[model samples]
Target: MDGEPRTNPDVPRVDDVETWTHSGLQAFLQALFFVLIVRPFVLLFLGLRIRDRGRIPAGRRPFILIANHSSHLDTACLLNLFPIRRLRHLRPVAAADYFERNPFVSKLTRTLFHILPIDRTARRKDASGQTGADPRQRMLAALQAGQSLILFPEGTRGNANEVTRFRSGIAWLAQAMPEVPIVPIYLANLGRALPKGHFVPIPLFVEVRVGEPLLPRGDREEIRAALESAVKKLKDTP
Candidate 1:
């Protein structure tokens, strides 16, 4: 069967804008699509470079993978970086409004990658316009269930691959689950390859730089700056 809703009967689907429940068929299709279609296309055309991948500790089921968000390629490149042994376990946290805006992208995203859709802005500011604190419980739940996540701490797309100030969620995740290491990834030239508001993608070389896994060594703001620094440093590196 195709993908269907799999969740506890009580936690409303609306709240699950950040949950990782997907279809077995879609996962299979995604592997086929990425391996046969996306992989060769990326490798032969826009090359991928993963710097110091060993820094990412092995055998960690539910660590956080945070990176800059310049284009959609940020997540796509990450899915390729993982080895076949751990590919199925990586979950890319996508925005609900963008990825699930329509039927086709929704289906593809859900099926191909085990995605956890999160409300980027709208739900956070409801009718009362009140802001809550660190509303990423679904992510925590996913981690509890042993699912590694590829998250964009920037929360939205940025310009020219510049690393933006991160949201507090990354810091929250690290603090909440100190055992899980937060991997900082630097994706170069993704904006040039397939940037925002572009349909036909250019065949440009892209690099994925993985840094040493970090914990919330400092407070939220300090940790956020450290993560950003890690990514920015890659811009000057080979």
Candidate 2:
């Protein structure tokens, strides 16, 4: 069924909407200080470099920026390269299991960044028991609200800079929000800077190239293949 609503049995429904109330400015300031001030210093000290930042469009629109995930630093590196004015409208779709593991990270992700929780495991059924909270639905809702999202289609980080096969969720999202552009991003040298295990990033020059926006066409499988191919081409670029 197209545009059908699905509920995940595992996702606990909150009785009150107030439970999701956002944090105040003071709280945001404190969080921003750490994210903007301390984090950048560390990254800079590690000789982090970003290239092709001009490719990212500077405007307000419901869009999705898809990239290859390589390390924990992926999100931070993207945020660092993202335009400052556009930050407020962009939300990153993060894994619930990883981000929600700690209270502080969860609050920061939910309040400051407006991240949406995605279920990685396919076993959990949605409220209708048909499908879980499809990441595409969340992306559509964000788009309908005139907000943008950041997604890593590979699902997880790999060892090399090569692009992994994209999951079908991205295709589904593109199909649902045909008007929204899907921006492909390539972050070079991130894998070596900070691989999967290492918490601390070594001094390494990183390049982020934002390619042309992708519009959906054909079936879900076809779109998925296109998105994967686009990402691979972005990675291949010098």
> Which residue pairs in candidate 1 collide?
17-117, 26-111
Model 2 Cα shift for residue 165 (angstroms): 1.0
Q: Using TM-score, give the best candidate's number.
A: 1
TM-score of each: 0.84, 0.81
Error of 1 at 29 (Å): 1.4
Write down the lDDT of every candidate, Cα atoms only.
0.73, 0.71
Off by over 4 Å in 2: 1-27, 34-39, 46-48, 122-124, 127-132
Q: How many residue pairs of model 1 clash at the backbone?
A: 2
Query: Which lDDT tens digits does candidate 1 get at residues 13-101?
Result: 43444444545665677778788877887787777777787777688567888888888777778888776546667879888767877
The Cα error of candidate 2 at residue 192, in Å, is 0.7
Best candidate according to lDDT: 1
Clashes of each: 2, 5
In candidate 1, how many Å is residue 62 off?
A: 1.7
